[model samples]
Target: MWYNQFRKIQKAGDLMGMTVNKELPLPADLKSEEPLTADIIALKQKRDREIRDIFTGASDKFAVIVGPCSADNEDSVCEYVSRLAKLNDSVSDRLVLIPRIYTNKPRTTGAGYKGMLHQPEPDKAPDLLAGIIAIRRMHIRAIKESGLTAADEMLYPENRSYLDDILSYEAIGARSVENQQHRLTASGMDIPAGMKNPTSGDFSVMLNSVTAAQSSHNFIYRGQDVTTDGNPLAHVILRGGVDKYGTCIPNYHYEDLMRLLAQYQKRELNNPAAVIDTNHSNSDKQFKEQLRIVSEVLHSRAYNSELKKLIKGVMIESYIEEGCQPIGSNRVYGKSITDPCLGWEDTRRLILKIAEEA
Candidate 1:
């Protein structure tokens, strides 16, 4: 059905002036998921188990998925992960650290840098074929070097298979969380997928997306009919929401968490959990505020035992350097080319503090 729908759109575009440019390689053709080195495989297995255990209430460790907003430079990202790899050992008992390696970024107005999956080189034109290969290679390198199975956003559901084998956790971004394809794809993945609240800030839409992802469905995926067994690990990610006045309002407070708990109870979904995105609308894109926001969330958890169980972890956007830079300017090493992110020093401090608090 998806192929047929694409054909119909193509036919209509042909009548206009649009034409098919090229056909890319299938996932299998691009890169086979040959087993990784035994050590890396063991690391992934352990990380995956810990994450699932946290969601299922079998563990009390806080999960922190932190890294660059978009992985623009491979070297800088790998360096960041190396730091996280070392830090993970220190806090392993209290926190599960999964570095965020978001390759595909959804632009709000369909403009700006679309992430490494589109442009491996920020200053060059998009070579999707090369972009595909670059992303896969980068993910492989991160895991091989850092011994960490990173988290990435499923910006394009169809493209997820390219790195699915390496990703320990997946997030359906605010813009894509409401889309049917994204939700369906999450239902089939073995890794935990966090469905973020939509831009509209509607809790029902977020919960409904979780419900869809946690239920079985038959759908057209990659030119094939596929059925999913329903992902019980599908959970919610409150990244805050934008109000009608075009303002970013927070949803990470005690009241907000209590409200989410109420909603989850009403639904009675499997492995109920929430991952609070400290940046985005919650911090109103003010990167520095992430420290305060995370500190407050931990305080809320300390205040309420139930909130601690429901709030599984937090998502943080941090890079080697502080804040963000424009796309074509002199790119700062480890600084974000997309969203402004918390700098490395503050990020390190915050993680240690979170571990201490947790």
Candidate 2:
């Protein structure tokens, strides 16, 4: 009966998917091609430890994950990270700066420039095999130029092993937070994994995801069954949320922070923390509002001792130039091709201010 039903669907052409365009080398093979030296791996391990300390409340410095919204060009991304390396020294005592080298961007409609992982060149057609190699090279170069290991989104859970040795922090985006695979992958991560609240922005949903990530689980992964001991560093990132009407609902306010804190108290989460994304729905996509949002969050933290302890950091979108440009022949250099970002001048000033107060 089952075979007849399957034959019915198959014969009707319903039991099919898009054919595989090409077969690429496995992640291990790619890592071998563009390998990280033993020294680099050791340095990454140390960096990972320091980052873990900050999220676990062992370090008092506030973390700022700031950089371009999407890393499109290799030279430009490396150059931007180089600048951050210089600034890292200036605020090392008060802040731990983690540059965002997000290579895989999530598109709402499953179209447009997916990111460097899809189209290594923004305007060109996608070449996944070339894209895979391009992204790995860029990450390696960025770390070598600047002694800073950075952050990237685990946009595709299976694509993670490709950059596992490089990324210091992993973010589960607003759209993928409530997913089972994403939550499971976070548990097995050795680095900090920040899970953003879903687009609908239900606190219970976000908290539940966090709980799941921090608890042990036995699940199937990549053609094999695996058991995870859970990731204690898995936490929440409040990027604000959107309602059914597509209106952005801001959740980084003090009242909202208080509410989250109350919720955290009721749970047995480890190293309970939250990182506020100053852009996204929190700023309602008004890129310029990120500065004000960061200031307000810092103000709220200073006003409340509990908030100061629970809210560990922020995520800011910034680049060499402010605003964004569409992908075309006359695209501006260093400006975002995806989401609008804060220009360099304002980003520098904001970090200095944060260090002074935070």
Query: Best candidate, TM-score-wise?
Result: 2
Q: lDDT for model 1, please.
A: 0.91
Backbone clashes for every candidate come to 0, 0
lDDT of 2 by residue, 70-151 (tens): 9999988999999999999999999999999999999999988899999999998899999999999999998889989999
RMSD values for the candidates in order, in angstroms, are 2.9, 3.5
TM-score, structure 2 vs. true: 0.95
TM-score for candidate 1, residues paired by index: 0.94
lDDT for position 82 in model 1: 94
Candidate 2: regions farther than 4 A off: 1-15
Q: Which ten residues in a row have the lowest lDDT in candidate 1?
A: 13-22
lDDT of 2 at 264: 98
Q: Ten-residue segment with the worst summed lDDT in candidate 2?
A: 11-20
Give all TM-scores, in the order shown: 0.94, 0.95
